[model samples]
Target: MGSTSKMKVLESLGPLLVACLGILGCTQAVTLEVKERNSTCIKAELSALLFITYTTFNSTSNVSTSLPDSTSVDAASSSCGAAGRPPWLVAVFGSGHALGLSFATNGSFYSVTNLTLQYNLSDTSLFPQSNGSGVVTVVSSSVGIWAPINTTYRCASPTTIRAGGAAVTFSAMRLEAYMPGNDLSPAESVCTADQTTTTAPPTTTTTAAPAPTPPGTPETGVFSVTNSSGTVCLLAKMGLQLNVSYVSQSQNKTVQELVNVNPNLTVTSGSCGGTTASLVLTQQTTTLNFTFSMNSTTSKYHLSGINLLANWSDMTAPFSASNTSLDYLRSTLGRSYMCNTEQTLLVVPAFSLNTFRLQVQPFGVTASQFAAAEECQLDQDQMLIPIIVGAALAGLVLIILIAYLIGRKRSHAGYQTI
Candidate 1:
């Protein structure tokens, strides 16, 4: 009889034990949320997605000589741009070396700065289908500069880019990069000239060289620090409107470029967990806020907040915190991926970027607390099952006790009557 009772007890608890184990298994796969600042960098490597030709040149005091060697790199050979079309992504890598000694030949060096690539596309067929515009231009700044000896880099331009035509040729095209020594900013001149002009090519070239170089124009803007890796991740915008002119000695003319903040700006949030974050930005307001969420157990994080502001020098358009709207951009329930592991820099469309840093907000979740929290959450639903069983058992005991009392009362009455 005792063995039978023990078996019965074990059978009674079997289902409950299975339920608990099921809950534990589910907890292991919970989505992790991180609410605070932690550094994780995602590697972002861009492939060239266009048809490009590279011609090496050696400059001297008397005349500029172009090597007989010219190589045309077809974007179709690489893993970038749209299929069955010209390349859309233009990735350029630079290094510091003797410009006159190495670049003049086919050699590279250490410590290069301000590696940038600008693209201009005029052909209508090359125009991106999304934005039906005849002109497409993009510039990348503050790239591949931080390295001990040399840094090889790749950056993607804004989406839906088209470039080059048969008649329009980029003459004297060079890479514009600067080295630390002598403060001589190397300038790559991608001169756009019509191929139809059947004239003698000019011997003189306008290169970004040592001193007596073009005036260094410093531009400023505000960048939001939504998230970042351990290293500095910075993003800024064009805050001022200015038309600057440059003297092109090779062309013997003045060239002008315009820098202005978009009156209306739109930024699409990144996709995480099969969804996307999005916002519309404007220059009239200030103050941007950020909110983040972290799960200690899983070490996962998410962000939500309003009115997060990034301030920079010389903001021509008035931006006040009061007028600022905070509901522009947001982070999802958990981290899309780890930070500081080399990820793509998400930028608003139609704007050129130079450099900025992003540092994630710090939120720490401990293992002890994580387990406790998970247990509590599980108890909220499962606790009802145990409570109902306990209530039923108590009711059964009460009925039995009442029946025994009734029997005793009847027996006492019978004895009194006798």
Candidate 2:
């Protein structure tokens, strides 16, 4: 089939695969446990978003898909490494796809040796060709680096490993291997991207005026989700900065990238409901979706969830966070919640958001202008700090004055009746 026709077929089958695998029932976590003679030798837990890319029938373009959350380890086929042999684990998806991981350890440290993905191309409902079952090695490494015995290994950014015509990407990954016990704890060793800095030539100094907004700084603007009748149901105004961590494929190190949400960018889509509303913004390879929910009893609305997906040139697969919960940006109906100060909203282990000059009114509103304002926690805290400090200073001043007055009385008592 032609590429266009093949894509159509795959698109049609997407919903079917979701049903066959019961995506809602699938868990995005995988765990491996190895025991020897009643003692646990290795225990690894991994929770992340996984993506796979491959080619079939000598196609020029690659086919990519995310591994379903329902995938689970095949304990029967997996084994622990011993002596000269290496340890391997196999995970099987309901769609007949299998992922395998091979590990190498030299007592002090351990590393991944290979990542293999197996699929049956003959399954017309999935792949484009009927090439029987094929196995592809997606990643291979000869060097060993993960160290220590009990600490978990964390790579909050996306890491892509490519081998031959296949590639695999793992994001927001946490793994614990060669564990002395069964429980998992905080990781001490973090994988980060390499950085190179260059010294700029010295320049003449000048008087600094009020600094203007930087060239690439995001500007705040009002965005609204409207109902079928054109009535606005949800409104927001903010300058957003998305922070994502990923391993650079070229540098082989993890790096954090901040992406600004251009307020000028058009809203791709949105939905407005009585109790819930959503707005989606897309710019280049990054897409952000913000969701809001209303509390009927309190007559207030709040930012309830966030979903972000980004595809960077330095990485092989897309970095994504789906349905991340949030508890801030709240205000009563007709009132806009405002925070002029910068605030951070941690969406997930791999993603966070920095919002500037945020103002949102997710429910009833009279005009485009803001009504009664509600202060954000950060702004309220900032205001409270000054008041607290002023009160403390006033108390200190009062105590000093009282002590001086008492000292004066004591001195006069010792002096002659002047």
Candidate 3:
């Protein structure tokens, strides 16, 4: 009897021990290899909760105010005049829970402003930038670095910022991406956004044709991407092909979809940052469908939602496949042929991956038409609310039915045959 009891105890504890080991193995930091070569771009997968600390230059108070983790205030209301309107400095961090922040900016600026971020979770401070004293003058179509702090961003002090008075010295803004739990909190990589002047292309009006390129017409093409190491990360020889289709609705003045889908993507002996491993989509497929809504008035193709299906391949510790739901906001011009280059951050449950650029060339014709505006609009709540309410009502009904049945059983027992 004693031996049997001991055997049962060990069996029950075996799975628990394995699970604990798995948790420990998975907590180590993950890095993404960022690559930008001409027009093609790719990066290692990332998944984690993201946080941000925004420091806005309060021109009215003549002091900079630090907003911890997605907090926002009005910039135009500040006494900084036009300088306080656009191009606010923002820091983004990722750790895993879901929250929402506004990335919509006024027409004059490229960056987002007037943010009142809200979240419901166990909040913790991940970034701590010391208070610094200084005033920086900014203007339209220029990049200025906020000043007066330690180079390592650890200690705070007064800062002096200056730029060219005659010609433009800086053309873009950059934000860094770093690994979690670093002692120095050093930035491993940087993402840059440039300011550019665009000329609107002339619009051509076409009368309705009897059967204008039937929508949802399936077209197939194969393209391959090779890394600097001479290893083929994506090869048509390795059974890779993209299937695309488009649908046009005339009355609604919208073009619904253009799906560029690839399946069974297998990577052999590929290096992601420092690790060389094989990558396989657990679902064995990846679909990037562009749902477009056209505005006839502006002659623009606004993106509605990007349907992405990404899962991890089978790998060992420090490398696991995480389910990902990517968010992207973009728009394009309405033209026969289009070529739009855009980048977005892919957020997963474990880490936030680096930026990657994607080019869409439809119908075997390559031309410039699509353009991307950095924005995020998610419908997570709209999809979740109905299910939550239904589940609560069903559970309440179940409890009442169970109580009624139990009461009847007790009443019958009370008048049992005596």
Candidate 4:
């Protein structure tokens, strides 16, 4: 925090750039198999074992101040040391506006050329976790700026992450290009009004909001979708992870698996006709004309569906919406939540978003409910039953005629009599 300390970090910059292998020598080029790049910006894959998600990075975005995996730390004499170069990222979790970011290289303050390019949350309070003491120099031929490596920002455009954090990508972290001597700060992902951190709700004296109606509590294979209420079809994802209150209409009362591709993309598939369910996920997205149609193995019947628009934000109104666990979430993290800005603290007043997405059949029984509904309807069609019965009767008469023609002739009359 003081220049004496900062100067030590600045002293380590420049003239010591390492191009050889890291001390641990873990800098192997990653071998990625089955990397499915689509025209879409993001893609995901889900199977019985491991789940994978991949997003294309047309550009670089901000790293929020909270969560992990955002910042790198512990620089010792070289960038190759695990303790020298920080390697962390940000997650959409935690309790407040400011994320904890700290990185120390060789226990000395430092000045480095560049910090990672980031889609910084719009927070005035956040400061670089870097030690701004090094007498470092930066050289970016494109930007045409060559100052002591005391810079914090990489000349990255902000347009890379206009939608939100759930859809950001990265090209590289070249913070050293400019500031060569500063101690690195811990990278953090700050949750703004748009991003949210989760905390357990305070116990209320008032009766807990009646547990969300589970999928198939009072009934089986029943589900509901809400958006001022229409045919309730179109939507991709607004976080549909099953929660404890989730009701199962076909199998057990809980879900087995969930796949969230993005804020607007998700997939939840399961086998449910009894107590235990095996599930799969195909696609859930904010893309228009998204369809979800699958068959239920129980009755061996057919079912299908579609939504008009892509799934939108989960915010319903006045800071409320559906979430991964079927619990209602207000847009804002909540009041009394602290936001650290340059040593200042703040709290949210209210929250909201564009749209919300819920299940058609409780938390884990959509396909089965659909199949059951069809089966129940088929059973009720007694009038059609009689018509089908009549058709069978006509077929029986035809079968009798064919048999007589094949076996009985006038010459065989005596044999028939016998």
Give a tens-digit lDDT track for model 1, residues 1-418. Answer: 2324433443454443334333332111111111112311111222121222211133111111111112222222222212322112222212110011001001132211112222222322322222222322222111111111122222111111111110011111222222223222333211112113345456676664432333233343333322212221222232233233344333444444333434244231111111112121223222122233334455544433222222223332111121111231122232222221112222222211222122232232122111111122233456678899999999999999999999999988887542
lDDT of 1: 0.25
lDDT of each: 0.25, 0.61, 0.26, 0.23
Which lDDT tens digits does candidate 4 get at residues 184-291? 323421112323456535544553333334332111121223122223222112222221112233322332222222322222222222211112222232211111
The deviation in Å at residue 129 for candidate 1 is 17
Native-referenced Cα lDDT, model 3? 0.26
Best by TM-score: 2
What are the candidates' C-alpha RMSDs?
A: 29.2, 22.7, 27.1, 24.6
Return whichever of 2 and 3 wins on lDDT.
2
lDDT of 3 by residue, 1-418 (tens): 2324433443454443334323432212222222222211111122222122223243111111112234222222212112222222222323322211111121211111112222222222321331322322211111112111111111111111111111111111122111122222343212112223455445557675453342332223333333444434332111222222212323223222222223333212111111111122112323222222334456443332222332212111111122212223333332222122223333333322222123321111222222223222233454467899999999999999999999999998899575
Candidate with the larger lDDT of 1 and 2: 2
- Candidate 2 residue-wise lDDT, 198-233, digit = tens: 454455464444433444556886777655465666
Better structure of 1 and 4 per lDDT: 1
TM-score of 3: 0.18
Which stretches of model 3 miss by more than 4 angstroms? 1-224, 232-401, 413-418
Q: In candidate 1, residue 395 scores what lDDT?
A: 99
1 or 2, greater by TM-score:
2
